[model samples]
Target: MNLNLRHAIMQNISGNSQEELRETIVDAIQNGEEKMLPGLGVLFEVIWQNCSEQDRQEMVQVLESSVRK
Candidate 1:
């Protein structure tokens, strides 16, 4: 898992249709991928750094709910 490649991918497609991205990610997860999730932490970090206060709170809540599961 290359962090630089991950960052590049995120930046390049940051504005693309999210549904397509979600489907691709879900497919990866269905294939029993490990990097699919751990990479989320990096994405979340990027979002956190740029998100507003309300968005940050929402992100934390969403992440917490997943953690509880």
Candidate 2:
């Protein structure tokens, strides 16, 4: 939950294969751990920085879906 751990996890994410990261994220969510949200926010920021307009819209959709749950 601390910023250090969050940064560490974000760094670790780059090392994970896509499937591994996907599983880790899914598990984190299923357990209802709010700390993961911050790290996910970081990931979203990283993606948004370079994402195209269409991708940004998709990201907003994803955010909306999460908020509705």
Candidate 3:
């Protein structure tokens, strides 16, 4: 059997508002469960695909800063 994770994740969150999306992300991080990682990755993929180049650069900078800590 095959699973389409990205499509499934998007469908699950299709109608979420900004507040709900934030809550979901915060909760996932706070919970620190490995299962949530792929979903976060998919979300980040969506953000990366949609965001501007400057925003992508900023995000990479933030990640670099976080990793150095």
Poorly placed runs, candidate 1 (over 4 Å): 1-3, 11-15
Compose the digit string of candidate 1's lDDT tens values, residues 25-56. 66767877776675555555667889899998
- For all candidates in order, the CA lDDT equals 0.72, 0.80, 0.93
Instruction: Estimate, for each residue in 22-66, the C-alpha lDDT of model 2 and write its tens digit.
Output: 787788779888867877767667778998999999989988999
TM-score of 2: 0.66
C-alpha lDDT of residue 67 in model 1 = 98
Among the numbered candidates, top lDDT falls to 3
lDDT (tens digit, per residue) of candidate 3 on 1-69: 125988899999999999999999999999999999999989999999999999999999999999999
Superposition error at 5 for model 2 (Å)? 5.6
Cα-based TM-score, every candidate? 0.51, 0.66, 0.92
Per-model RMSD to reference = 3.3, 3.0, 2.0
- Which residue pairs of candidate 3 clash? none
Indicate the TM-score of model 1.
Answer: 0.51
Ranking by lDDT: 3, 2, 1
Q: Which model is ahead, 1 or 2, in terms of lDDT?
A: 2
TM-score of candidate 3 versus the correct structure, residues matched by position:
0.92
